[model samples]
Target: MSLVSINPATGEKIREYEETSQNEVEVILRRAQNDFLSWRKTDFEHRNNLLYKVAADLRSNAQRYAEVMTEEMGKPIKEGRAEAEKSAWACEYYAENGEEFLASESVETDASKSFVTFQPIGTVLAIMPWNFPFWQVFRFAAPALMAGNVGILKHASNVTGCALAIEKIFRDAGYPEGCFSTLVMGSDRVGELIDHPVVKAVTLTGSTAAGKAVAARAGGALKKTVLELGGSDPYVILEDADLDQAVTACVTGRLINTGQSCIAAKRYIVVESVAKPFEEKLLEVLKGKIMGDPTDESNDIGPMARHDLRDELHDQVKRSVDAGARCLMGGEVPKIKGAFYPVTVLADVTPGMAAYEEEIFGPVASIIAVKDEAEALKAANDTPFGLGGAVFTDDVEKGELIATKVIEVGTCFVNDFVRSDPRLPFGGVKESGYGRELSQFGIREFVNIKTVYIR
Candidate 1:
């Protein structure tokens, strides 16, 4: 069977790639294992220099990579470029910091000299999603590779072109023959890949169901797994918030990546006293957003990654409207060609509605009005997802309190939209999956923390 890449913006097939057979998979795994043995022995200076070259290559050809991504998965050309640059930043961050992050730590004990050393664990399989195709893989690859582990990527079928392009970046940067490889196949092969003896660990960035399945499979193999799964992140707008600032942050957060991001703000929990004005400002901004060809650069929103995904989001919006939510604007699919869905707004969202319950992975915003801060906090934490969140308020102390102490999420922002940075740890709790990515914490996820006591 072959994996087909489609231009989601035009509903046309871009290319088809033949799937990797079991024999080919074995060869790749064996090569990766061999490379890892030597790669793990490389000193920090050599690894760091190679990664710096990789980062330079990423920035130099970012636009070309962006074009490939835009063609394959319907990401806006601008956002695609930004994604490539961000991926480069991750490469540099890990390159500069990996050695320090993994340095042995001395611990006083009864033994003469006790310390913990981080060591590379061989091959790691990364199962990545289509959205932010380049960034997701680099975030995992840069850290894993810098920590001395080789990577075998099983990216989403639709973004196969992107997966190959990323592989090329590392290959051209003087990395060894088996330092990185992309498997152009469907999800059916993931289990076998995880079960491979050469694969010492697995990391996945995708849906919750997929995470669970991979986690189960990897667990059966006694291999470690780090999952970055689905998120229905909430933005709490307190009564004391600056209406203008709140609307801008909320709209930008929700519409980012056309709302395909797992950490994109999905729900807006606003205190009732300011709900009307906030909604008015948000609608005004949404109305001005242009939805059209992702290649145009003028369009503010592009189509969902696939026709089926767009239809699924529409179904969720329709279900919410039918279940008592009020549609303020843009609920229907556009008549134009492609998988485009217009910027949609739903207000009065409450329990039992699809918008309130499930993640709407499109450019749709759900507004939930609350009686006060207490109710707003309650509504924010009502969901099963604890990925990321944001709080907007003029009262800095209160906003900080809500962001730092009250919200039950892995990361929180005060008066700003939630974003993943190379300097910070990004992940979630509860159903959004466990384990962290980025920062020092991320680089250590795939390593063996060995304890040594010298007498």
Candidate 2:
């Protein structure tokens, strides 16, 4: 099937791309392998300088790139612009810190001299997602390139234009031609690419099933893989928490990226003493959010990326409510032209309900009331996904204690909402997938740590 970019806002076809032929794919792999030989040999300073150039290019054309992303994926123009800026930040961050991060280190050994050096693992295949289209790919690209590994991006089908633009950004920055290339193809073709001799490792930021598939293929080939998958992250509120701050943060956290983020707060677990007040404040705040066209600067919430997603989230909400959950406010789909689901808030969520178990990838939040902190923690940990979780409490010690007890998550935020930063390592545990994606640890994910010993 042909890859097509459809505007989810108006259901218009923005562009169409033919899948890369098998022969062309082989040629691309060979060229990438050849480029890696020269590219990897380049000094760190040169690579860092080129990456800085790429960041500059991205910032210079941020508006144009944002518009393309908005048109292709229906993300609000403002958010799209921010996404591009974030990509630039990732590029510059890696450019600035990569050398030190990858520098060899001395270790004590029985031999006279011993050290461990980081080396580039040939070509890497990046199977990225559509949500945060530019940011997702750039985060992987920046660190991998800085670590001396070449990248081949197989981005989401709907964001092909964004993918091509990213490739152009790198080329414009004066990097070698094959240092990074966008492969316009279907999901089925990924296994072939993973098994190709030129491709040394694979990294994916997508659904759990997709991550598992690619990881299995890479494993069979004896190549390393990194998988960043989904989450139903919890927002836990203790009785001693700042009720007002927790409520406001919950609204923003749950609705960020229109609630499409993997780490978006899907479950709200509140201690019984503050549950009623929290729910009241949450409903009050959500009522004022403006939903309309993403291009409008005044709009707070835009449509989901596509109609099918909006419909799916709506159905999930409906099922949750029917399964004995109470709709506190805005449960039905909003009366709008585009793929818009209302900013919904559901309460009285039980463990057996679908919303409690599933990740609602839209502006929907499920509030589960608990009798005490113990029950709150139990409810929070009762999910297959453990990407992230947040705790709000005035007592720092109490918050830290609670955070430590909530096992299975890759990261936890004490008295704060969860967010991804370039300076911190980000990933998830359990079904959320394995492997780190940012910071010093992230840059080393695809590199070879070779140990040397001298007699």
Candidate 3:
């Protein structure tokens, strides 16, 4: 079987990569095991220097790498470039803070001297997705490598070019040949890695279904795992919310990355008193947007990562509309050559409808009106997903109450949209999967924290 990358913007085949044979997979895993032995012994200063080198490499060739992302997944050129910049930042962030994060902590014990030390495990398998292809891998890889563990990436097949390019970046920065490598393989082969003797742990950034499968397999193998799954994040708008601020933030949050993000604001729960005005302005902003070839600088939206993904999104939209949700704006799929989904807004969305129930991974927004603050909080926490959410209101005290006390999500913003940051931990709760990424906590995920004492 071949791994082919098709341009969603033109339905054009970008390239095809040969699949790795079983024997080759064995060699890769063995090499990673061997690499870990030496890598884990390296000093923090050595790893830190190489991290900065990788960051410089990404910045120097950002545009070229960004084009690969745009060609493969159809992100706007500008956003793709920004993704590269963020990838670089992840490298620098780990470089600056990893040593302190992994440092041994002293504990008061009856024994004269006692403390806890962090040591690296062996190889880690990263099963990443195509959306935000570059940032996703680097966000995991930077800290994993910084903490002295090697990685083998089984990235989304459609973004194989990106996967290989990342390998090159690490090698160019002077990492050992086997320290990081991309496996040009299919999803079925992920189990081979999980069950391998050399692989000590696993991490994934994808769907809820995929996360569950990986978690089950890793559990069976007694391997550590970190899974980041799905989200139907809510953006709660209270009656006291500033209409102008709420409208702008919601529009940007819903339309970011064409709404393909796991943490993007998919559901907007608005209080009844503010629903009419908020909906009026949101529709105006979404309708006035331009979308086309991602390479074009003027377009705000671009084609989804693939046609089938876009088709699935349209199907979700269709079901919601048929179930009585009203389409205030572009809910219809474009009858064009590419996999472009329109800027869609589904109003009067209620519980039990597809729009309100499922994660609509596209440029679609669902507005659910509520009678009061209590109902608004209930609606925000109604979904099975508990990834990320936001609370928008002019009353700072009220926004804090909702964001901190009410929303049952991993991360919630008081007056802004939800996003991942290098400075903070990012992940989800409930069926959204377990474990955190980024920041000090993320760098410690793959390390073995052993308690030590001297009598």
Flag the better candidate by TM-score, 1 or 2. Answer: 1
Candidate 2 backbone collisions, by pair: none
Location of the lowest summed lDDT over 10 successive residues in candidate 1: 188-197
**What ranking of all candidate models by lDDT puts the best one first?**
3, 1, 2
lDDT agreement with native, every candidate:
0.92, 0.90, 0.93
Question: What is the lDDT for 133 in model 3?
Answer: 96
Clashing pairs in 3: none
lDDT of 1 by residue, 316-384 (tens): 999999999999999999888999999999999999999999988989999999999999999999988
TM-score of each: 0.99, 0.98, 0.99
The predictions' CA RMSDs to the true structure, in order, are 0.8, 1.1, 0.7
lDDT of 3 by residue, 224-295 (tens): 999999999999999888888888888888888888999988999999999999999998888889989999
- Candidate 2 lDDT over residue span 64-111, tens digit each: 998888888777788888888888999999999999999999999899
Clashing residue pairs for model 1 = none
